[model samples]
Target: MAVHSPTSGPCRSIVVSKLVAPATRRSLENMSRRSGVDLFFSSTLSSAELTDRAAVAVVVPVPHAEDEVMEMVHRIRELAPTILLCGVIDVPDQSLWLFAERNGFNLVSSAGGIGAALSRRLAADDLGVREPIAVLNSSDIAGRLGLLGEFEVEGCSVALWRGGGRLGCLENRCTHSGAKLSEGEVEDGVVTCPRHGSRFDIVSGERVRGPADSDVKHFDVFEREGRVWIVPEP
Candidate 1:
């Protein structure tokens, strides 16, 4: 949602915590603003800059080391001391993702799917809805699953998938034999079940080929209070 206070002019600006080349920044900013959102960078982001405004979403790239990320989180919380809304993207691995979400970053994801992730989270913030749980970033899951690595989403998996280049949550279980879809291959927007080579469309969860006779489940994901959330089955 593009929101602005009368004094703020256009209020749809995000503060990024890492440094990109100026050219890359300009290109990204130009592309994003066309959608009415602006991208601003501050490698050492200050909370004062964040809280001084009414509605702001802070995007931080998760650092590799556990300690570095924790340090960064603590620093931001300390400086902001007011209400803080935090989110993280481009998490390199699951351990780091857990660490970040546990600390303060409620929105977790990989770089490719961040556009939609930010949009969802920011919209939630505007509505004053804070989720009680911190959903896992499927960025690591995207890498693992795309490589035929093994993972199972016991409850719900919010994936900013590699194939569709979109953010969606799907029950990554094989419709037949209940196998984990992450152990199989994803090609042309379809995820395969390793057990018997069953395949389902990643977007619609429709069964494409089988051993699997049924479609996988898809869930809606949204963000608020610094974390992305999976919409539960009704």
Candidate 2:
């Protein structure tokens, strides 16, 4: 939801972390009074600037190594507001998403469908309700036999599932190298990465074996009236 600010600026403005061009900073600062959220278009923002401001920052994917990402996550948690991650490619693991959610950062996809939705919402300045919305539903017991649900609850796809009394949610990106985790396989409590031979526990989202040491995000799940909801912990 694009939260329209009652004031002149956006409820927040976006600042690309890695894409923090001098001109871009000038532009954001010039209009800082009106803009509320600062979207770090990519993982370009220097560590120093992310935490001091009260504005929300949207971190995108950068070509950073594992240690770099962990450092960024630590800083992100320190600068808590409302984080929306975009364009994340699944690589060796799903640590970025896991760390963000663990630190209370709202994990949203920067992929095609949900990524576009989140970008549009932020552009429009509307943060309605930070709740999860179901997009895809699965009951096909023969072929896949798993529930596929998209979390557009906040303009991004935070896909979730609850089949056979099991519950799981991920950032919609596979940890094996950027494949959509939602499109992956989940059986007997394991979610198989579509790209490679990686499996994650649906309930805990931990990559149990093979190439993925990072954990996928696990949101708070609830069902009512035959509908499922994924709520981020506050």
Candidate 3:
């Protein structure tokens, strides 16, 4: 896997090989142990195409030729491997978050290298996880001063309320189709999705509004070092 920094323009580009070319495939198979390239293999058609796009991205190292990885992904999508590994090699210079969101591909690299340090960190949930740092410190303080009870819940995303000097953490996931409640907007104590118009209580994790039949998860909230923490159940 190749790790890349978030860039302002499209990620680095590479020359994409023709998927049906036989010599290209043979050449790829022959190339071994390169010092400065990202390596990716897949066995699905869709993933292969996606990989192709990733290959020519000169913005980052093209470890695996785009065509080859795509072919691999097309071949293996049905096996459902025991593990799926992704690497975000380097911290993106810009909105790595937005890029992942737009492409629906999670980042896997934190370093820009091709060594063992580039191995995927799939088991650690927080390895590359980045969230919005609360900007309204005063609001958080107010919320904490009021203190809501702690609880565990699950949803598409996490939710918090700006009240009483601290926060009341709520499960931001919607059960219906597992839509992110955080992506929804809050109004009158309800967080409603712009996607399907699903709604829930921002404080209770209850499905007050729906296209969804299930409630979201809630978590215990706390504050330390001027930051809000939600201890979600493992």
Candidate 4:
């Protein structure tokens, strides 16, 4: 949020879990000074620290691999579900926000976009936001099982794919231009964007072709008793 008088501030607490970039670190530190929030930096977070300090949000940078970031999110959720989780990426990829949200993160913004997200979150934060697990049936979809399929999960567009003897679900928007991935072609476990020829792997959510800014999000698909279940987390 913006700067406020100390006496009339919400006095929020946000922790920087792993910020190594100089520019982003400076930007956030300056904002924290002006906003009157208890923003601080720490590499490690114990259960006691989270509970004793009353941290409202945790800022984690996605480095090395996205899987490591996901692990941290799960750990934070287990320690305290009410604390908001924010994931920071290297580039500006607004398209991955849904993917981040679906996987237990409250907000996922690029290095440049984190400020806006933090401002909005601190201004109007929620401690108990959650979505129930969603379910779909194999017989309900009106297409071949191996073809690309679209559905809704936690109010976000999701695409289901069954190919190469493998089954999985993924976010339906391209990270490059926000194009509908369902309109594209899925072959050999890769989804190609119809507009710009960008390709992404449905299984790992990695960008396989360019003109694509970043990779999409993936969800695990479990099939049993003629029904398909898609979990929000991958």
Candidate 5:
């Protein structure tokens, strides 16, 4: 299933592998058409000839064996460390999902869920073009002592905290496994991920511990007229 959309530009490219189901392939193709994304469908992960031009790949293993899945993921990661990886599984299971996450696959989801997930990752850069959203009121955030509150800005989850009389805001998703940082404990200007205990400096969004090699996304926060506002991406 090689689809060349007229809208396919250099901005985004996607390679989909191991999706044998005709319906699944067609669904992804339809999504690519609607979103104007470049779509390349391949039969196997190893055979998929991806170049630096490719941005991400959706991998679906035909076999449910844990070993096979792990091997495929390992191969893909070895071949393309910079390319974002997403796994599409037919059934929802905890063990397999955790295996994918622990191996550094950015997202793992059911076949029915991959289209939306891929779309979100593809459009992530468009956040910079959108307007800043007002998250909460300063008065509403004041007097929280340590953890101020959590809010959503333009569909992006954000966590707010105040330490040493200075307010800080960061993307709620943990850099390690996308856990909600708001659910984790905050201490000494660092927030820990509840899932893996990855700590991040709330002020700079820098990773302070293991398992998270990247920094969490930081949002510019400011107060205007008694309200707190956030620029989703900078």
Candidate 6:
């Protein structure tokens, strides 16, 4: 039982099980129409039923049957290791989501929440999600006064400063007026926003001066393998 929807633009191949509630199936069909993704509905997880071109498969397990769900997941993993697996539950259960994640499901969501979750996943992929990025070499930073540099990672403009052998990374945009902090001046470990003179402690990401009441967003950074690495904010 495969149901096709009207699609547009670049489409992603998706296989969904018909065992889900009718409302869930309708929601997925509507989501496919709006998102321009292809959908294939099946009654089971059998290899003969699933299309080889499918990139993702949404499985709906029977309610309150944890063991049966795990068995199906195992069977699917063994049959199609390349396809990303997602589990949809009729009821919202936190423990079930955790179990699915631990048992190899890439995503787990409530039946009604599946559309929104899948849409977010697609949008994240479109934006080219960012992870940890190397900013500079540890040798490039000097002791005491430290070093200051600007970088663009994962579509975010950021400023990196090192002081007293400690490194700090913050978004370049000022909290007050969207000014570029990289254009500001740094003194005694505090960076003054060039536009409104708002001051912030780079090391602590704390706003020490007025006009910018909020603290700048801080990013995790560490020195590893003689290089400074920045873990982009999720």
Q: Which candidate comes out best when scored by lDDT?
A: 6
Candidate 4: tens digits of C-alpha lDDT, residues 39-116: 656667666545433466678775444566557766875565555677777665554554455445767776666766
Best by TM-score: 5
Candidate 2: deviation at residue 51, Å?
Answer: 32
Q: For every candidate structure, what is the RMSD over all alpha carbons to the true structure, in angstroms?
A: 11.8, 12.3, 17.4, 8.9, 13.4, 11.6
Clashing pairs in 1: 106-226, 106-227, 107-226, 107-227
Write one digit per residue (lDDT tens) for candidate 1, span 1-234: 333332355454666655533333443454466567655566557654555443355666666787787677656655543233344444357877765664455566665556666666556656342222345543434344343222233455434344644334467666688776766667766776778888776645668888777878764443334444454443
lDDT per residue as tens, model 6, 1-234: 234531322334567777778767776777777886677766665675442543445455534566776677657745564355667777767776665654446567777777777767756655232345777876877463533688987888889876533566788889998998888878776788989999887755679897999989766565656777776754
- Candidate 4, superposed: residue stretches over 4 Å from native: 1-11, 64-66, 92-98, 126-234
Q: State the TM-score for model 4.
A: 0.47
C-alpha lDDT values of all predictions: 0.54, 0.50, 0.39, 0.65, 0.66, 0.67
Question: Which stretches of model 6 miss by more than 4 angstroms?
Answer: 1-11, 48-51, 126-234
Per-residue accuracy of model 3 over 1-234 as CA lDDT, tens digit each:
233322223342122223323333333233213323333333332333333333322112212333443333323222211112232323344444333212212222333331233222222432222222332344435524222332233332456664422244566556777665555666655667667887765544557767887767654344434555554443
| Backbone Cα, N, C clashes tallied per candidate | 4, 35, 51, 0, 0, 0
| Count: clashes, candidate 2 | 35
User: Over the full model, what C-alpha lDDT does candidate 5 score relative to the true structure?
Assistant: 0.66
Model 1: residues with Cα > 4 Å off, grouped in runs? 1-12, 20-31, 81-91, 127-234
What clash count does candidate 5 reach? 0
Report how far residue 57 has shifted in candidate 4, in Å: 0.5
Q: How well does candidate 1 match the true structure in TM-score terms?
A: 0.43
Where in model 5 is the C-alpha error above 4 Å? 5-11, 44-48, 125-234
Q: lDDT-based ranking, best first? A: 6, 5, 4, 1, 2, 3
